[model samples]
Target: MHVIAERLIDDGVLEREFTLGEIPGVLWTPPSASASAPAPVILLGHPGGLNGMYPRLAGRARQCAANGFAAATIELPGSGDRPRSVDAEQARADLRRAVAAGEPVDGEIVDRLVLPLVEKAVPEWRTTLDALLSLPEIGGPVGYSGGVIAIGVRLALVEPRIAAAGLFAGSFVPRATFDEARQVTIPLHVLLQWDDEGNDRQMALDLFDAFGSEEKTLHANMGGHTGVPRFAGDDAARFFVRHLR
Candidate 1:
């Protein structure tokens, strides 16, 4: 965890940009965080491309800080400044072409696009967790929140350090994600955008139903992708506060 830069964002939230080998990431810690009194951390997830996602990620991070928690997010495999995967790029192109033509996306394209990403990204997230937890100012039990829903599913199922997850259900969920979802036992809070053009609403609901968690809640709103309302974010923050505090 090599911190490349640090600045105070606002309300005394300290934002740090860092790199782990080739992967770049950002971490935000609240003023209350310290060795004597560490803050619980939330790992923020996104579809991909950290640079494009920074503003929203930072807003969520500050919200986490406001709620007395630290937040961090790393660029996904083949995203932002990382080396791109040719296979992933092709699969993404296929998806976009299908969407542009108003044709139903083939399941094979989703499998090709998301499955490998899940396989590679989950381990990186676990490694990030390892590094973050080692910091005196950031401690567990950790919470995960955001999209690339498949990544969140895999982490909740396999990563023991994650106590709960608040997943955004606005992406393409591979079939393997449903299989994994059925085995996840951690608490979950899923947000669904009913009118997201790129997402299959039924699939999101089915995936939520497949979750094995004894405690789970779904928040469905009438909006497009990126139209998640502020109140919804407030609700998610409360969800994390209940579990992580």
Candidate 2:
């Protein structure tokens, strides 16, 4: 895998370093020029433990780019490019508050900071979608893949443009997450492993049951938390092409 640390922005689709208050993040985009045609766009959310550019995720992003899709992988507030550690009690308190409020809690405690970063991210992704649609080379569909951030599946369901999604060893926080996940109406493809440490098989089963969409497919592999070694990357690419396109 090739790693390059640089700010990225293309046309109206901007991929640059951004900060949500004190939290720093990286953004991505498609071409900016407007045209008659529109292409699909995907906003990728990375796994919790790994950085955005983890080998598996990097491979997936490259595959998306090679397959004529605009894919952007962004690091979560507390992970990669931005790291801050809090006491266990503080962390538990924040998690509790987020559970109570039904949203992501990032940053210092007591402030109850609920950044609308994902909400804001939707428009940025839409801008890239518009740019992609304008391009003559892309005439197919658009979608998203939560490389490890399966929680984004719930978010994608609320958005109108996300036609499909691919999630690998996804993490769904709090029990209420399944309730939000049930609202998803698009095709959702989940890849889970039996021995995975991050997410258990039962969670995947529950998510499968919670999904309201009739077009859901679940694949259980032999690998552990990371599904890469167990499942072939080519198979994943095929699955994306089969559903997203």
Candidate 3:
């Protein structure tokens, strides 16, 4: 598909920080000459442990833009160029407090700190969705994807405007957050590697079964944790076309 990279500014929506105080994301759309009467939109979430401007996620955004959809990829709080200003010691203290309070810690220190940030950022995602839907360029359905960006999907469910969703390498959803996925009614597509480190094949199967939507699918790629099926490239494009249209 045709692809181009461009920046978007405050066309109409205000540029603001997420609740977790992350860098701002610009809204993207098709150029006026090439866009349809109304276009679909996708809100892309980047994977954890990488700069917010991860190439794969950005590639997907460009792909979506080329395929006639308005796509927005937001940098989560404390990631990308705006690394978390919170000191390591202070972050450790927050984790200690959370653990002492009987919050789930699961042997992963990052989760302890990131969960709270995800919690705070959920409402910001909601507001972003509202703003996206309000744009005249976005008229079709909405979709979401991130290798580990399912946390954003959990938050996106709070808004009814989202019509479909896709998750890549999303292995964990805390028990408290499990209810969020269970409540969504739209179609869901999950892409997972056969040997993903974070989420195993069985876990992906379990999540697919748990989804409330009758129209849910799980796709397995032969690649390892990061290697996805080449089909994924096309699957994602078609997934948007089938549902967003």
Candidate 4:
């Protein structure tokens, strides 16, 4: 919970970079946020590598801020400046090799690559939520939005503070995630790119179907992985507003 740097973005959004122990993260609060009128928060999740993901994370944070919610994201384990795992690295190489050879990725490889991440990162996110909500300007009823859907699913099931989630369906989802998805009861807005080259579209659809939330909406669009339309983001923001506000 240490503040390392701070700046004001356009439209008076406050951006702060900080570390919680060894985990580096960024937080953005809107102009209207304050102790007297604390803002609801959105935790932004991503596939590993915060430095490469910063621009998009900042863009999403700005959108959340504009909608009157504080947004924050933490670096995932074995990502960015964090220490790398030899096992995870090997699993990644195996996955890439399979993909490059136009072969189906083995389920074991997917488990090896993603399960440990979900196990480690979910607790980190809970800790981050604890720290973020402790800030005077960031309040409860949190929403989680982004990829690494496994992490989002785990949090939605286990973290009582998270009221809703807007999940991006462009990542590799392991088999065990489907079982977890069935236990998640929070409201969900899942976005899927039908033509995503790197993602298995049917898996995304099945995962969407597996979510046990009584209130869950799927937004499947015709596009590649990075081709999520601008309007989709607007729709996601509205989804958060519906729950977080």
Candidate 5:
């Protein structure tokens, strides 16, 4: 792990930008956080690719820190300093071709586009979790939020370190991931944009119905994929607070 920069931001949150291996991310800690008294941590993931350091992500981290927690986000595979993998690129190209042809982005395209990313990303998230937890300023009762909803599903199933998760349900889910969802029993807050033009509304509902978590909640709003109102985010933040704090 390499520390590239560290500074205090809004609400006295300490933002440290760094790279782990080829993955770059930002770790936000509260001003009072220390190894002797580490703060609760949340792993924030974004859709499509690694988003690196961005406003929404940093804003969420600041909110987490202000509410007495630490938040971190890592670069996903095939993005950022790393180039897109051949297989992932091919899948994306194929999806584009199908979408341009007015064909639904389902079936083989779903497997091709979603599975490869899921296969690579879930373990990478787990690895990132390991590295983040080893840090002195971060501690357990971790929470996860944001996209490539498949990543959230898989992490809920595999990463025992995560105490809870806030999964965005505005992306296509692979057929096999529904079974994986059955294995996830953590406290989950699943967010959905009911009128999302780009997402499969049925898939989101089906996948939510498939979760094995007894403590899961579905938060749906009438909006497009990115048109989710601020209150929905506030609801998710409150959910994280209940579990992480």
Candidate 6:
């Protein structure tokens, strides 16, 4: 991990833009934080890509800092410094066909378009965590939030370091996602935009229902994907506090 730049954002949050190998990203540390007393950290994921970092994920990072935690986000694969793999379009076509046909996508299709990325992404996140927690400004009791829903599902199933998670469930879910969700027993707070134009409503509900976390919550709001009320962010912040603090 290497630091690219560090600066203060609105209300005095310290935003440290950095890279893990080739991954371009930023880390936000709360104001008045102690290097000696490391603060808890959150891994903030995004729906679109790294371009979603500023103002959205960036704002979330600042919020985490204000609520007394450090937060960081890495650019997902096929986003930012990473370009889409050769099979990306084929995978999309395969998925569209499967969804249209109302059948499970073939395992090879999953391996090509979706699972490979998930496989690559999960490790990068773990590696990033390896480097992130080592920084004196970041401490334990880590949490994960935001999504490319698949990544959130996979990490929740796998990464034990994340003490809690707040997942945005407004994206397509693979058939295997529920299987993964069923293994995630950590405290989870999922945000759902009820009428998202681009999402399959039943899939979101089903994925939430499949989660093994007895503490999981589905925070459904009556809105399109982007219609989430501002206060919902506060509610999620409180959820993190309840679990992490």
Per-residue alpha-carbon lDDT of candidate 1 for residues 1-245, written as tens digits (9 for 90 to 100): 99999999899999999998789999999999999999999999998899999999999999999999999999999998899999999999999999999999999999999999999999999999999999999889899999999999999999999999999999999988899999999999999999999999999999999999999999999899999999999999999999998
Better of 4 and 6 by lDDT: 4
RMSD score of candidate 5 (Å)? 1.5
| All candidates: CA RMSD (Å) | 0.6, 7.9, 6.9, 0.6, 1.5, 2.6
- Which portions of model 2 miss their true places by more than 4 Å? 1-39, 48-54, 83-89, 92-141, 147-150, 230-232
Alpha-carbon local distance difference test for all models: 0.95, 0.54, 0.62, 0.94, 0.85, 0.84
Q: Candidate 3 residues 1-245, lDDT tens each?
A: 11133444333222222322344565566654122476777877665433435556556766676677777656565566656647534665765676578775453555555566676556766777776666566675777766444475575477577788887655454444455667767887778788765554665676667678778777777767667765786787788788887
Deviation (Å) of 126 in candidate 6: 0.6
Clash pairs of candidate 5? none
Task: State each candidate's clash count.
Answer: 0, 10, 0, 0, 0, 0
Which parts of model 4 have CA positions greater than 4 angstroms off?
A: none
State the TM-score for model 6.
0.91
TM-scores for all predictions? 0.99, 0.63, 0.74, 0.99, 0.94, 0.91
Best to worst by TM-score, what's the order? 1, 4, 5, 6, 3, 2
Residue pairs in clash, model 4 = none
Give stretches of model 5 more than 4 Å off: 48-53
Answer with 2 or 6, whichever has the higher lDDT: 6
Highest lDDT among the candidates is held by which one? 1
Q: Tell me how candidate 1 scores on lDDT.
A: 0.95
Candidate 6: segments with Cα more than 4 A from true spot: 93-112
In candidate 5 the C-alpha lDDT for residue 128 amounts to 77
* Residue 139 shift from truth in candidate 6, angstroms: 0.5
lDDT of 5 by residue, 42-62 (tens): 888787444533878888788
Query: Could you give me the TM-score of model 4 versus the true structure?
Result: 0.99
Query: Residue pairs in steric clash, candidate 3?
Result: none
